[model samples]
Target: MMAPRNIAPIGYSGGSAPRSGPSGTLGADNRLTTYANTTRRRVDTILELFFADKARRADSDRLPPDIVGALHAHIFAGGSRTRATLCALGWQSNGGQERLPGAVLRAAASLELHHAGVVAYNDLIENQEPRRGIVPLRRMMEFRYVSESLGKQSAGLLGLLTLAWSDELFHGARLTARQRCAAIPVLAEMRADVIYGQLLALTGMDCDLGDVDLALRIVRYKTVGYRYEHPLQLGASLAGANPDIRRTLSAYARPLGEASQLCADLRSVFGNPLTREQPRPEDLQRSRTTVLFNIAAAVADADQRAELLTLTANPDLDATGAQRCREIIETTGAAAETVRMVAQRRALALQALEATPIPMPAAEMLRVLARRVTANIPSSCCLGRGTS
Candidate 1:
């Protein structure tokens, strides 16, 4: 595939151009940043309007005020906003105008609500104590419940309600019949992929640690389909993209999404202070089988494999144990291998992008995003990096 054309390097400072590099892709970063910021602002506005509508009805609704408040808080809590951003990018890349139509913005923002519902449900399943840097929604609702059972049920109900609200917001968009028809199937596929991925993960939770294929299958369905492919296709569908364009976008999205998830996995275990705050390595503590862990186990010597098995056997690994597990992973070169996989997938994604006939701006934006997502993995998480 030929290299991307018409790219300009971004200048970090104001009013002065940096010396052009061999690629001359400097100003593209500035453009991508502005585009991302605009998408975020539009999505935020949609969310505000949604919350306003809810507030107007809250006074008369039978639900308690605190429940509504908690829901609002959960929505407002910070996140990467990746799905909505991708939706807007996909739409714009597929021939949507610079000034996004209200319907498009509404459709894109609805993905955020759908994500909120998924996270809320995920928290319940994982029995997580915190979500989006705050107390889990269930715990927030616990005080309002008459009993623990009632609280749990209410939390689940809240998640379902969010999903309903997502559908409501989506339909509220003034999409044409064709757009609706195109978009609905993509949305359905996204939801089903996530549900299936979750089921697979849950079922495989206690399976053998050596099952790398199963682990990666979970990543493909859970991360690639839900987070990347579906959202991109939804945006493209909204823009009335043809089947061929949608198919081409998926060709780019699949590897990009997997690379994105692998970067996330590395960051979660190593550390990424850039995108979001790092959390405790939940995969280790929960003994969840991930591609990284499986890779390490597969390559480990007999004693190292035994060590991994011992560490993962604990449901609540302490900080020291988590550190030891990280050491084992690094020592075994799994960390480096994971980083290498990210680079390989990223290269494949770029190659796919080069082969596609998408608009230059969209293709460039995606290339920039691919670099951004995978940028710091090797530097921050490599074996000799001293574990942050």
Candidate 2:
């Protein structure tokens, strides 16, 4: 495999405290506080709108009876809402009105639905046993009233259909026909690219390492571009962001997305400050090709590094094995290195925001808010609930 790229981490240098808000009181940073509060409110509204009874009214007619049960179960079940949060914040930053058009709201909620669908499929493939603190997908379907195969099939198909619905929702926007048409291809491309990233991570193919260029390409393609930039772009698209503003968001999203994903990488491997429920951080067990993983594996001594590799490569390793691997990684100091990297990425994200024309105070507030999310792993935020 080619060596991995070395982009900076996405978080601050401070310890795993998830509540690292700005030093000043909420009084001083009220604009940021307001923005965050508004963002959270909007995120909630978006979810309610998307999953509301009205949202489900069309389902029975739209989906076959066999799959509707599974589809309804996953959609109504609470989920990360990360993409919706991203879109809401991005829309606000782009000057979207207090009551964003229904189209934009639909788009934002659909982004989350697609994300959930992806997770459901991923769990099935990876044989993961838990999601949002619930029993595994297999158990959810089969253990209660049906067979495991029926449950698996239901979970898998529901996820797939939800993904398709996410696309249709985007296409159904109220924007000008021309604008909507233009946005569809861009959104579709971003959605497809995320799946590609998942495939690359799952298959463990040999990737090129010598080219620093490839690393950015991988990160941009697999991580940054899809995670933040695209969602921001979609929000920008909704608000009709000018070319310049769009370009600026593109630049800003890279570091922010990297930091966010890096934090996830940390939780997956070292420990999640946001939600500590993972039996094991999925990244290490899966040997995800995160930038931090590349650095840690490369930097460790031969014996330790080999041990890390061996542990991850074992497909049969269960939760017990995941715990053992976490021990190996911690002993090798890889966990600390991962923390350091998150700090670096956080800095990069802030720097990108600084260079943009966004008002300095507002930009600072956004940075602080980003920090808040990063800091709140396993503690304030359970994978299933609000931030700690």
Candidate 3:
């Protein structure tokens, strides 16, 4: 077996809160501001224009405007636009140059649309109410159709429709047939990987929470491959990046992705003041079956385990119960253990990034992004180490 690279993590400071994009939205990067070549706002604007045009076309064809409108709402509701930006960054970093082609930008736009579709499907599968706690789509559908079953079926179809819209954008981009053909395999693989990972998670939803290994496997496909690796590969492929650069990117992408997902899981449970992500009750109450839960269960004493089971199983788990759950997670050192895992993965990503021979602005921008993953990890998490 090949040994892991022993690169020291240099040139990496913890990420600062990224400045707002042109429309004053926070996302996955700061370079989107400093680097004029591409921005999240730029990508978002492209998506907005496409969706607007799509709505117009749908209206003209006597299609359901509400469906199109709802799809539009879900897409813009909230997201960091991480994949789209990564695609853009990959293009610029690999000699696609300052003026990105319209085709490349549109290709990047497809990633967000496709991601939105996937998220909608996840919302259905998880069946949890939205974090905002009201779902207008389902409510509107139930009111119109008069059947909850019809409403749910409509939402599922809508999710699938979003994916078709993604394909519409991809096919609509003015790339040569050859370029489209070349990029197909990457997108195809991304779709398959994410689906498989999501299915794995769905099958494991029985409060088993199995172990770190199972949850990490889900992260690898569901988050890492879907979010990081494929998007970058698509962009690099569009830019005609050489094999060597792709290899270096692969090295950096995996660990960065894993660390990013781990940190996000941490934020969702532990509360991130910077991101304003409070501890979500549904996340704990609904048998989330996540890595942190597994770690806690794996290490908890008999009493702690019983309390955790009761809290997680409670249909009416309140803030008080959720706090107790956090306490159990903390005392068992699961949060800290996950934190250490994140630090290691993050360091490996940075080390690989430092050695990558990409151009100056792009390389530096990636370093900034690498730090952003751990930016919101509370200082208190650092103290949770070894409490067990």
Candidate 4:
């Protein structure tokens, strides 16, 4: 194996390197903020134009106006825009120039739409009620149905529509043939990976205790591949980065993505004030099988295991039961193990970053993003008003 490179530590306080693009000599946070704000403005513009176009043909369009409203609401709802940010970072890694290319921005914005569609569908499948502190798109539409079957069908159609819009935006971007060829297949792969991962997770809903491999497999495909790997690759591809650069980015992305998912799992149980979406205990209530639960099951005593199984088995876990489940997970040492795993994975990601040949600023941005994704938020923050 090639030894890792000796890149400067991210956010290093030593003499700063010259800045790239319009970011100037700004620190990691400032650079990220600049990118995020710019991308957000562009995304808002895209959505507004889309809605405006629809309004012009409201009568001719087959979709209901309310559905459009719901989609708009979903877009405006709280999100960290992590994938999009990573996309921009990937472009920067390849020496992308000033003013933030329009093609890159459009492609990045498309990621958010794709994510929205996936989440809507996932919420329906998991029977999750609230998303971003409001009723999910499917549930909102389900209210119109006289029967569960009809409601599900309608919601499924809406989800499909959301995905179609995502594609429309993705292909609508102006790109060279080379960029398009590089990016389109990756986008297709991302969608397929997420769908497969979801299917795998659903299949493992009744997974046996201590099924750590299955849990990680699900994470690799569902969270890591779709959320981290694909977006980074997509951005790099759009920048016309070579295969070696893309491979290096993936190396950094893999461990970071796994760590990110682990942190999310931890936050779901321990609570994070920084996260403005999803209720605490939401994971427990949904009985979403996660690595945490699998580890807890593996370490718990027989009686404790039985207790956990029973709690998770409950279709509607009450607050009291939720509390007990937390206690069981904590007392069993699974929580501690998860924390350890998070740290380990973060270290691995950073190590990969140090070895990457990407530009220093891009590498630093990835480092900053890694910390942002994995760090625990202060308790004083609200659960519905922070980065996603």
The candidate that achieves the highest lDDT relative to the unseen native structure:
1
lDDT (Cα, tens digit) per residue for candidate 3, span 316-386: 88999998998888888988988888888878887886665888666766767777666567666666654
How does candidate 1 fare on TM-score? 0.87
Q: Name the candidate, 1 or 2, with the larger TM-score value.
A: 1
- The Cα error of candidate 1 at residue 233, in Å, is 0.6
Q: What is the C-alpha lDDT of each candidate?
A: 0.76, 0.59, 0.74, 0.73
Worst 10 residues of 2 by lDDT: 1-10
TM-score of each: 0.87, 0.75, 0.87, 0.86
Ranking by lDDT: 1, 3, 4, 2
Q: Report the CA-based lDDT of candidate 3 relative to the real structure.
A: 0.74
| Candidate 1 lDDT, 226-319, residue by residue in tens | 7888888999998988777787789888988888878777766776544344447565654356788788777788999998788767777777
Off-target runs (Cα >4 Å) in candidate 4 are: 1-26, 145-148, 273-282, 377-388
Lowest lDDT 10-residue stretch of candidate 3: 1-10
Candidate 2, residues 23-75, lDDT tens digits: the string is 57343345544544444455456545544543456565674443444454555
Name the lDDT of candidate 2. Answer: 0.59
- In model 2, state the lDDT of residue 299: 54
| Model 4 clash number | 4
- Segments of candidate 3 deviating more than 4 angstroms: 1-30, 34-38, 59-62, 132-147, 275-277
